[model samples]
Target chain A: MNKTLHIALSGLNAIDSPGPGVPVARGLREASGFDFKIIGLAYENLEPGIYMPGIADKVFIMPYPSEGIAALKERWEYILSVSKPDVVIPNYDAELLPYIRLNQWLKEKGVASFLPTEEQFEERQKYRLTEFGEKYNIPVPESHSVNNLSELAEKGKHLGYPLVVKGKFYEAGIARSPQEAEDWFLKISHKWGFPIIVQKYIKGEEFNVAGLGDGNGETIAAVAMRKQYITDKGKAWGGITVTDPRIMELTRHFVTKTQWRGPFELELMKDARGDFHVMEINPRMPAWIYLAVAAGQNIPLATTQLAHGEEVKPMPSYEPGIMFIRYSWDLITHVSSFQEFSMKGER
Target chain B: MKINPNLAINDTGFAFDPMTGHSYTLNSVALEIVQRLKQGQTEEEIATGLADEFDADPVIILKDLLDFIEILRNYELLEHE
Candidate 1:
C-alpha cells in the first residue's frame, strides 16, 4: 500500500455540465489500499471542485488550453516546482492535447500520467470516428465533417434527417431537418470553431462504459452503465450499472485493438437488432466515474496504480445493478478567497 | 441596477434565479461585478473600483461591465430597470 502519493486532477466542474475530476477524486479517496493527498488543478478559480472541502488538499489554477502547449509547460513546470505531485490525471478532453505533449516531460520530472498516444487521440476524434470504426471493424454510425452551412447538405446526404450535429470539441444538437442542422451547425461552429461533425442519429438505448486501458491493449477494468434519467443537456442524471456481455466484449476489443493507455468512456447505442453502434469516444473518464467504483471496478484507483507502475490484474467481473444518482451541492465560500485565487493563482 | 430579489449567488460563482429557475456559472470577475450590482453600485462606480483594484483601463472595464449587465438582463437576472 502506497502511504503518501500526491495525485493531481483536473476538470472539476460539478455543475449541470460536469467534469470527471470530482468523482474520480471520490474514488481515490475511497480507495481502501492507499492514502494520498488530492491536488486539484483547475483552469478557473471557481471550478467548484477547488472549493469543495475534503476534495482538494490544495488547489492551483492552470492556463487555459487555448494559451497553447508552451504556456502549458511553463505553468505546469511552475506548479511542479512547488507541489510536485506524484501523478496527474487530466479529466477534460481539451487538456488531453497538451497533456499528451507533456507526457514525457512530466515523466522526466518524476510526475507520471497514463494517456493515449497522439495518433490514438486524433483517430478517435469525431471527424475520424467513422474511420476508426472501419479500421477496428467496430460498428459506427456514419459521420462526416462540414466546414460551412453550404457544405451541410452535401456532407449529410447519406446521414439523412434527424441527424446529430456536433462541434469539434463540445456541443451537440440533433437536427430533424436541413434547416435545423444548418442552425445547429452555425451555433456549434460559432461556439467550438469549424469542422462540425454530422452523424447519423441512431435511435436506441444509450449505454456508456467507462474503462481503463493498461497501455498494451489490455483493459485493466470496465464498467457499463444505462442512464435511468437523462437531463435536458443530454447528461445522465441517474444511471445504473448493467451486465452486458456484448458491451464488455466490445470494450475488450476496443482497448486491445487500440492498445489504449488510459481512462476512456465509450458512448454506444444498442439498436433494435442488438448491435452496438459506437456514437462517440470520450478520451478521459466520464463524470459518473464514481459509479464505476460503486460497481466494484475502482477505475480511478486502477489508473493511479498504473501511473505509479504498480501491476494491476485485469478486473474481469463487477457486481452489476449499482446505480448512481447525480446531484448538485452548494459550497459556501468567501469572496476574498476567490479574489486571492484569481489574482494570485493559488488557493 | 440591482440583482433580481429571487436570485441567489454562492461564493463558488453559482447564480440561481429562483423566479425563472435558471442558473448561471459566473467567473470571479463577473461574480464581483454582480455582487456590486446587488449592492446597488452604479456602472461608473463599479468600473472605477475595478480599475483601482486590477490593472485595466476604466473605459474598457466599464464597457465590459455593460456587456456583463446585458448578459445578466438576457438571463433575466437583473431588474427590468
Candidate 2:
C-alpha cells in the first residue's frame, strides 16, 4: 500500500481567470507513486473548487494575506491541528509572500513546501522587469513605473503611444493615446494601488512556457504553448504546444541564471524577426498547467516531489502540437455546504 | 508532399490537424490545392492544373498558390522540409 500524502493548496477559484488549484489537484490525483488526500485552503466560500466533486477531501477558509500574517498563522494553526498536511502549495501571487515567510514554521510543524526566496521573488516584480531583464541578459520590453498620471504622461512621451499600462499585481491595458493611457492609469491604480507599470507594446505572437526549476540551476521540466484564442480578460481560452527550440533554450537560460526554485511561468512575445522578448514572469504554476501534464511532463507532480525533498529526474522531452481548450462547467450542490463552510470556516 | 501527414480534410473544406488540434476552413481553391498536395502533386503540377481549370494566367495562379502555401506554412499545417 502506498503512503498517503495530504497536500494542502490554495487558489481554488476555478473561474474564468482561474486559480491553479484545480489543475494542480487533478495532476496530483494522477500521480502514480503516492496516494494524495487534498486539503483546500480558500479565502472565500464561493470558490468553485470547494464544492466541485473530486477536488478536495476537506475545505478550510483561511484569512486573506492582506489581513496580516498573525491572522493567517492563527487560521493555519487551527487547520494544522485538525487536518495535518504533509505539504502545502500556495498558488496565488498575493498569498505567496506570507507562505514563504511561514515556510520555516511549516517545516517545524512537519509540513513541507518549495518556494522562491524573498530576494528571488522581489527581483521579478512587474515594476522591476527592466532591471531583471538587464541583470539576466534577457531581452525585455522597455517599461517605466509611474506614481501618478503626470509621471505617466511624461514617460508616455518617451515610450510612445500604444503602450501597455499594467498594475503592480494584476490588470493590464493597452493605451493607444494619451487620453487612453490616463484612463487605464486611473482604473488600474484605483484597484491595485500606485506605481503603475507602463510597458512598450510589442507587436507579435505571444507564447508562454511553464517550467519547474531545481534550486541548483537546472530545469526539471518546461512546456511551451502558444495561445490560439484569448479572452477579453487576456487569459488563454485555447492554446497549442509548439516545438520551438529557441523558446526552450530561453527557458533553460532563465532557470540557470535565476537558479530559480519551484514552479514558474514565463510570458514571451516573438516579434516578426523571430526574436523573443520576455514579457512577464509568474512565480507560480499557470492555470493551463494541465496542458503540460497532458503533454507528458507533469509539473505539479514534480513540484510535489520537490516539496518533499525527494529527487526528481529532469523531464527533457514532451510531445509538441498538443492542444488544450478551456471550457466552463457548472457544478450543482446544496447551499448547506456553503453555509457549513461559512459558519464554521471549514467543511 | 509538404503538408502535414496528420491533417484531415472533409468535403466541405474543413481541415483539422490531429497532432496540433488546430482546425482551418479552406476556400474552394485552397481546398483543391490541399487535396492535390495530399495526393503527392508538386507545386508546378498544382499550378498547371489550376491554370488550365480556371483558364487564367499561369503566373498569377502560381503567385496566388504560393501565397496560400505561405499561409499554410505560417499555420504549421505543413511539415518542416
Highest DockQ, which number? 2
Candidate 1: regions farther than 4 A off: B1-81
Q: Model 2 - which docking category?
A: incorrect
Residue by residue across A1-347, what tens digits does model 2's lDDT show? 25799999998999999999999999999877768999999989999999999999999998988898899889889988898899999998889899999999989999999899988999999989999999999899998899987899999999998999999888899999999999999999999898899999999888999999998999999999989999998999999887677888999999999999999999999898779999999999999999999999999889989999899999979987788999998889898988999999888
Alpha-carbon deviation at A301 in model 2, angstroms: 0.8
What is the Å distance of residue B47 in model 2 from its true position?
A: 3.2
TM-score of 2: 0.90
Q: Estimate each model's TM-score.
A: 0.80, 0.90
Per candidate, native contacts kept equal: 0.00, 0.09
What would the per-residue lDDT of candidate 1 be over residues A18-101, giving only the tens digit for each residue?
A: 999999999999998689899998987788998887898888898899999999899888888888799999999998989999
**Residue-level lDDT for A61 in candidate 2:** 91
Clashing pairs in 2: none
Candidate topping TM-score:
2
